[model samples]
Target: MPVAPKRMPFFEHIAELRKRLIVVVVTVVVLALGLYTWGWQIFDFVLRPVQSALELAGAEKLNILGPFATFTLRFKVATYAAIVVASPIIIWQVMAFFLPALKPKEQRYVVPTFGTMVALFIGGIAFCYIVVAPTAFEWMVAQAGGNSVQVLPDAALWFQAVLLLLFAFGLGFQLPVIVFYLMIFNIVPYNKLRANWRYAYVIIVTTAAIATPDWSPVTMGALAAALIVLYEGSMLLARIVLSRRIGEQKRREAIMAAGGDPDEIDALDA
Candidate 1:
């Protein structure tokens, strides 16, 4: 007779975690190298918004400041790009590492959630690249003391601001996943979440204020709005995904409320 496989011991679990971490690290590092080789092209795309805003403000190019600025900027860009590109694999490895602890039903949800998370992160970055960065840079340029001041920002700082905002938006885009999982685990119930919109809005605004590196009103407001929409969207998705589970819970509650047979309802709940 074939033997059934036993669960991993504590040390084995630790080893598996270490292995997953290693894979994530190696994937990012390898991707970084490849992206570094194509750094300039990446720049042309990622930096387009800032560059356009600068050009419009009469600055032909960014200030290069010091000898190693270009090298350092390219290196940072490549590393960030690698993280952005390798996000799907990284999220998968991280989620897969914890799969053994989940119930079968829970495990089934993880795969689809993984893809949703990747999409959210990428969407955030793209939104920043295409909209947030461009708008913020243009507004900043316009505020730079009028025509007397040229808007030739330091290359390193420019890249830093742009990258920071991109990452901020990317993470912001994952609000739905966070909300959905909170519901899934009953850490926060669906009805409570829906009922407490004011508090949630406060938290979202505060999170946006902190997460956005610029601390600009524009970026913060944009992220907060996007997150609010995502939060509401998550509620809709949860209702659909957990439709049957939620329906059963409602039925049990109704029986309890109506003073029906508690024993049978309790048995089914358990």
Candidate 2:
């Protein structure tokens, strides 16, 4: 059999990355144009749930800021839509381009990792839209105490805040996958992570508290608690992966100690 060649040089990898990035950028732009064409309808769809909630709460009106706020809002929604649409393709391109450099076993993990990432990202955004945003909006509105202050919702700012929050939550949810990879590479041992759990818990809570825009203790405290739960969940997953790796390592050692080829042990067991 022909031997596989060594990986490409750093410059070659960079050039490939540049090419892939261009493709992703073009795809996003095309999708954005489509979204812009139907921007108003999409905007209405996005805001419909919040609008209902506001109306139910007896809010007189949802006001937009500045003459251009409407346009900016539509464009912002369209851009975010573009990102949502292009994410899978972008991830696919990246995975395909980088596959040659990864080990066969590691490559097997890619599809599931991508899927988990996509699901987590969508889940985070949905959670923000469904739970956090509405709750925050309601609290803020109630706090206004029927004052005549024009609660003009800036379209651009609203989406910007939502997008950032969504991204933060999504990235936060990737903690498990990250730690699993770290364990796989022996960069962070399971025992070390477990030993530092207390510190990690503190950091997670602090980060969650800071990530929320609301200054209220209620929101910050809730976010912090949620972060702690997620941290523990990630640790649980890391432990599972670490256990599997340890089991494989032991099996290999057993075969070696028995004066048998590790690969042949599988056939013998069969």
Candidate 3:
């Protein structure tokens, strides 16, 4: 038998949330400080894709318009790095907060789900860096019409765009996990998701358009295609998993109704 979960009063819940937030904040601050110590190295690593793109476009170097721009950019880089470093802890805190609300079976999925979320986020960032960014940059530069106009990107703007694009891709890749949770929690049925494919496609296209850093159709199309594939794949997996879970639940109910121990039935099967 599963033990009942402890209930907390509203104020206690607020206090727990505050404690978690504090932990997250402290972790981020510490990571940010540590990254700031080596900010230049991180900045270089982050700038590689853009630098390569600029070189391919025949640009020499990015322009720094203001004296304080470099400092600000470095700080931003550190902050972003900090967030990346602290992501696992952040995920843990979120999961911990909601664990009490989940049933035993649902709780079993939390760790795996969190792991999947992290993997998908990293995959999204890698996809953007390895494929999307380079292609988009090359395409955008090609639009300059054969050396008629020189491409001189601002250092701050360039870094900001890269960071935004990375973050966008990372978050966008959570669609499957989100869909899985919705179905698992019965917030949305599999039939409804299957029936609403057309609407989902429209939303995914709009999201891809908005999230992509470049205005080029190539990047947008690539993102949209990836999102659509993830959506369909998630739906298929959800259907299978949910069907199995429902079947098992029905079997357990049948065993209970027959006044037989489900645990004994499981042991006998084993």
Give the best candidate by lDDT: 1
Q: What TM-score does model 2 achieve against the real structure?
A: 0.82
Q: Name the runs in model 3 displaced over 4 angstroms.
A: 1-5, 146-149, 262-270
TM-score of each: 0.85, 0.82, 0.88
**Candidate 1: misplaced stretches above 4 Å?**
1-6, 147-150, 248-270
lDDT of 1 by residue, 146-238 (tens): 757656677777777888888899988998999998987889988898899899999999999999997888889889998999888998988
lDDT of each: 0.83, 0.69, 0.82
Clashing residue pairs for model 1: none
Clashing residue pairs, backbone N/CA/C < 3 A, model 3: none
Q: In model 3, what is the error at residue 207, expressed in angstroms?
A: 1.7
lDDT of 1: 0.83
Q: Which lDDT tens digits does candidate 3 get at residues 141-180?
A: 7788766687777777777787787878888999999888
